[model samples]
Target: MTLQLDAYMHEKKAWIDSQLPLFLQETSIPGKLKESMLYSLMAGGKRIRPILLFAALNTLGESEDKGLSTAIALEMVHTYSLIHDDLPAMDNDDLRRGKPTNHKMFGEATAILAGDGLLTFAFQIIASDPALDGDIKSRLVALLASAAGPEGMVGGQEDDLEAEEKVLTLEQLMSVHRRKTGRLVGFPLEAAAVIARATEQQTHSLTGYADHLGLAFQIGDDILDIIGNEEELGKPVGSDLNNHKNTYVSLLELEGAKKKMADHVDRAVVFLRKSGFENSLLAQIAAFILNRTF
Candidate 1:
């Protein structure tokens, strides 16, 4: 049977969303802090990272149960990044997922704390899981930290900030996003490979798939910023342009960006085929990135 991507996405997203609050509730955090954290964490967005983790697990013939904590932790870290990225000193956005940003709703201090809390708590979730062995936990913790930390997403953010208002070459732009966006996107696949004990050749292929998919994702986002509906996106469109940010669209033009995104999607699917996951949901997701509206 052909997999229904929408239904599959909705199911996975629902599962991730349901688990997020339960994990938060397990903590003995202060009431206000907890509330602030939950507010942003529960805010609606496509839980793509977690879904990707689950999808990777499925592709590896592993049960989704094995990746539950990892998926939740990934989402928590992603949510934390969004909360901080929307802060006054950052993107300074007012809307996120169609509601007031965390800082806008809960004040800057609380938002900052909430982001910090989520980021730190993510590692704890992985570490404290009784189901995962110590070695697995250690590996996950190291991988997650590296993906979300100064050498990865954080470093990419620094490059992005520095490149603002200045034109960047396509190579430079790719470098910035590879760390900031691609690393996290790639993390799910790598983590899944670790969990499933995938062979080195399989891991290499998945890594190749991830690199192209990550670029496709960013290119799609850049295209959406130019043409997507504000209501559908929940956040304002053209914010990239307003910020004078160099995007795939800005650097390559609208049609050029679209073509570039399509190329990456094609390459991603080829890698999936090489990894023996050609017909899996991972391939569908690459196609989704090619035509995503949000």
Candidate 2:
């Protein structure tokens, strides 16, 4: 199953990698800004969010290509977030995907502008896509905006920076995790649901699935930070410890965190089953997230 999933993931990732450059090519913005955007954008990651979007659309019997524009937009938003997250003002990371972070390659100023360019360009892609209805496009724009805006990923990040050295309770930590990771993970699935005009029950189930899956994914990340190899992680390990961040592993201990992650994966699988769609691919994705090396 791992082999098959790997094959499928590689195929989807290749497709996304091939298409991402074309989107940057459409930008009329002159100068090295485009180069900066493409630098981090093309830097390799799992491409999980866009793949989830495609898989979710497929589960609903919609053509996977129907979600392509939105998928690209989500990737842009993701890349933009990473670029900013790695800034000296933020996490101050030195490596990403085994390469120098955007700020390391480009100057800090150029990196900031590159993040800004990609972020706004995401909206343009959504607005310019001819396939979606006006109403659908509007809703999608609103959803993506809110997910990536102050109340979502950015807000979570702000809290994260402030929460350093502060011992948070489980609930407080979960709140941060939900906002930081869960919301973005849920965005593409929810968008696919909306675009497919899914049933209320179907949407609810998929939302539940995404919530659990996102939590499990984050927990897995926390676990990996303690035990994962830097080579495979493409970054240094013990970052959470070095930063004094209160992670699941810190609060729950290694065994406890693993158990919690397993529980979330189980609950996610149950929700996926409740969706009543042929979602084997999504189920596999949840499993992969829980068990991934990076």
Candidate 3:
């Protein structure tokens, strides 16, 4: 069956959106904290990480149900990162997805706590899933920790902050984003591979595809920051310039960055073809990154 990328993305995104709120309905969570967490978690975006997990599962010939808990967990972590990223101490942005950022709406302390809660709860969700065996749960937990922890997203964020106002070589910039943005983006595919019990070779191919896809995604983001409409992005464009942050656009110029993004997308497609997922929805997603508006 030919994959309709738009329909596939919509269906998977809807599934993730419905599942997200249900995970936070526990009575043990304090009402205000729950509200704050849900505020950012439900904030609208493409839900790309969770959708990628489902797409990877499908490409690996596994049922999406097998990765349901992991998908939700991934989104929680992603949202948590966004909450922290928007804190006054961090990006200091007031808008996300067309609404006030969590800190702006809930206060900085609550927003910090909300981010903390989501980050911790994400691991708990994977650890406590009834359908996964102990071994799979352990693997999932470890991978999530590595991806969201200091070695991955957190590390990249720190590097990005430190690099502010300092001109970075292209290699240096890529290194920072590989951790800050790329790790989380790559995690979905790796987590799905774990759920599907894929062979070593299959996992390798997916990981390769993920690495290039992650770079392509970041490059596209850099381009969008310069050219995207604020209404469409739900936030101000050129904030990178305002903050003096080095980006692909800053380092490579607009046209150079676009060409570099295209290069990564082409390489990503090669890995997908090697993995025999060239016709899968994952391939379509790689293509979409080339022209994404927000």
TM-score of 3: 0.98
Q: Report the backbone clash tally of model 2.
A: 0
What order do candidates take by lDDT, descending?
A: 1, 3, 2
- Candidate 1: deviation at residue 280, Å? 0.7
Candidate 2 global TM-score:
0.97
Model 2 spans > 4 angstroms off: none
In the range 1-294, model 1's lDDT, one tens digit per residue, is: 135888899999999889899998877999999999999989889999999999998899988888999889998899999999998798999999999999988899999999999999999899988877899889999999999999999999999999997999999999999999999999999999988988998898889999999999999988998999999999999999998899999989999999999999999988888867898999889888887898
The whole-model lDDT of each prediction reads: 0.91, 0.89, 0.91
Q: What is the C-alpha RMSD of each candidate to the true structure, in Å?
A: 1.2, 1.2, 1.4
Model 2 C-alpha lDDT per residue in residues 11-87, reported as the tens digit of each score: 98999999999987766876688888999989888899999898888788888887899999999999999999989
User: For each candidate, what TM-score against the reference?
Assistant: 0.98, 0.97, 0.98
Q: Which stretches of model 1 miss by more than 4 angstroms?
A: 1-3
Better of 1 and 2 by TM-score: 1
